[model samples]
Target: MRIFISSLISGFEQQRAAARRAVTALRHEAVMAEDFGAQPNSPQIACLRGLRESDMVVLILGEGYGFVPPGSTLSATHQEYREARETKPVLAFLQEGISPGPEQAAFIAEVQAWEGGLFRGTFRQPDDLQDGVTRALHDVTLANATGPVDERDMMTRALAMFAPENRNQVVPTMLELVVVGGPNQRILRPAEMEAPQLVEHLEQTALYGESRMFDRSLGVISGLDGSDLLLRQERGASIRLTEQGSIVVRLPLDEPRSARGFDPMSGMVLVEETVKERISIALAYVAAVLDRIDRTQRLTHLAIALRVAGADHRGWRTRAQHAANTNSIQMGHGGVQARDPINLLARRAALGLDRSALIEDLLVPLRRQYPTAN
Candidate 1:
């Protein structure tokens, strides 16, 4: 992949060299203004053209905002960044411990504010810049290799694996989360899945502690069918990891239960605090799982879907009410009830840097379904 390195060329010569070396080390072509000699078009025009042709942009910001050419309000680097952000992924790095000028500070703030496609990092030295750039480029390379996926179908099949035999049985309300990652070539070998270390790692990272998806038990059912690794709890929760790097976790949510017959008061109460905590724990576990797998196999991207089942009659309440009692807050007549699943696509970098943003992105729509309480 061709990566465009954008920054002020005057005082940032060493840093730019470092970034170029890092990009070339990964076997990716580095497009820099320094490399472009006499061109038919002006310098700014040539720089913009080069940035447009690149697959990704590595934006290095220092204390200076660089030269703003004639007939243009923005600097050359700024122009490249504006154009790159529209179409390509931008990996931004800011120099640490140095105060920036007003314009440069504003530019940095603007870049940081756009968290969707931008991944931000900080470096104190040339070597630090090189290392950060190399790692970022590697991640982008892996993301590019992850082919297209049918996320809806993937979620459907994953849910089927944990479906109950007796359809009439009233099961507890559950939150089913599915994450699919891969290069679409290979993920985990069957032998690797059964390794004692891998099982131990999963138990420690995902299945243990108070926030665990399943109950603490010695009975862990591990099986291999074709190219998938299946782990299940005796209760109801189950986890399926595919050779193509897909993970499906089905676990029950904490909700008020009906003792005997149909109780109108007994319905799904999604407390705001509890919902946020659970989602955070689940995301952290998934991130740990991916990191563990990344040691052996590279992952491109993650397709994450969060589905809440049996929530037809649901109530949204605050943490204070939930603490008082599960049934403290009665069913509300208002609030948009959501039956559809929440699907999200995240690059590998976003999982680490923009986790809070990811949580908000997933929960914002879900939260809107509930009305504000008095």
Candidate 2:
């Protein structure tokens, strides 16, 4: 497999070379920015292109945050790492026994917080990093040899939990999120979903200190097909826990009475803040459920999907636009969906670390569907 090596060039020349040697020794192609002698595009573009081409990424974090180019908020190394985490497998190595600068330290913390797509280690010298990389790559290869889980199939199963007639009659202008554990993860039994602790965790966890996502007053917790658990709300919001270890949350987004002044028949208007809050709540609930089922902090492969349905002729509005009473930009699409498999830490604390970035990643495709403003 081809691997991309990403790091700051000035401070970690030795480490980069060590990583390259390790990759070559394993008979893998190591792609680095230094090897690109001359390219028509800028260095950032070239580095990202190399990263996109590679199957895996080896990220080395040092004391410096590297150079932040003009018109970019993040350093090149930071950008590369972000890009790699979204798609390719990443093996991250942090330089130990040294104090990183404020920005670099924050970046390191952010990376450590990410619950998905990471194989992390620490090293004091180039040799240690090289050995770690070799071992990590071997582990990843073996894991891949088992074959990847079918994310589309998992999504289909999750969606099937909601009956077609019920979905059409009850859930309109809804945000549906599903998280399914991969084959390697533990398969939750029907009894586990009925555990008192799990139900309490779902009802008690507050989304914003006071507002809870699941309340007994608004919903009823019941059994489904003798194997799955369902929490159906009166207001069209619901949560389904399947024996196959999938958590599906459906929240209605359209309330014509609440969002007055707009013609409800035209389409739904999605507020940025409202959408963010709902996604955050759904993820928090998923994390809580995972924690309740299995206490292990080990990485678990998971397939996650987010879908916005009944979105034909929909519109999206930012907070600023809403305050100014400006019109929302038309989505020009029927529905939006995003699905990807990830290796996650499966803990609430770990999910909190990169939750915003994860949410943004899921929203990117939907955002792109909106027409450009004049």
Q: Candidate 1 residues 1-374, lDDT tens each?
A: 88899998888889999999999999889999888999999988898989988988999998988888888888888888889876777889999998888988889888887643334689999999999998877776665555665556555544454444332346666667777764444667778877888777776655664347666654777677566777777655667777666777766566434465453333557667767776777777677677677642266466677766655456776767654564445444534344556777776657755789988888877766654332
Clashing residue pair totals per candidate (backbone < 3 A): 0, 0
TM-score (C-alpha, index-matched) for candidate 2: 0.51
lDDT of each: 0.72, 0.69
lDDT of 2 at 317: 73
* Per-residue lDDT over 1-374 for candidate 2, one digit per residue giving the tens place of the 0 to 100 score: 99999999997889999999889988999999899999999999999999999999999998889889999999999999899877776788999988888889989988877734346899999999999998888776654554456556555555554444332332477777777765444456656777877655555553222335644456454556466677676666777777656787888666434445754433446666677778887787777666656443232555566766655455677656655654434455534332222222222233545677767776766555545321
Residue pairs of candidate 1 with colliding backbone atoms: none
Model 1 whole-model lDDT (C-alpha atoms): 0.72
**TM per candidate:** 0.65, 0.51
Report per-prediction Cα RMSD to one decimal. Answer: 6.5, 9.3
After superposition, which runs of candidate 1 have C-alpha atoms over 4 Å from their true positions? 21-28, 35-49, 61-86, 91-167, 207-238, 255-268, 295-301, 310-374
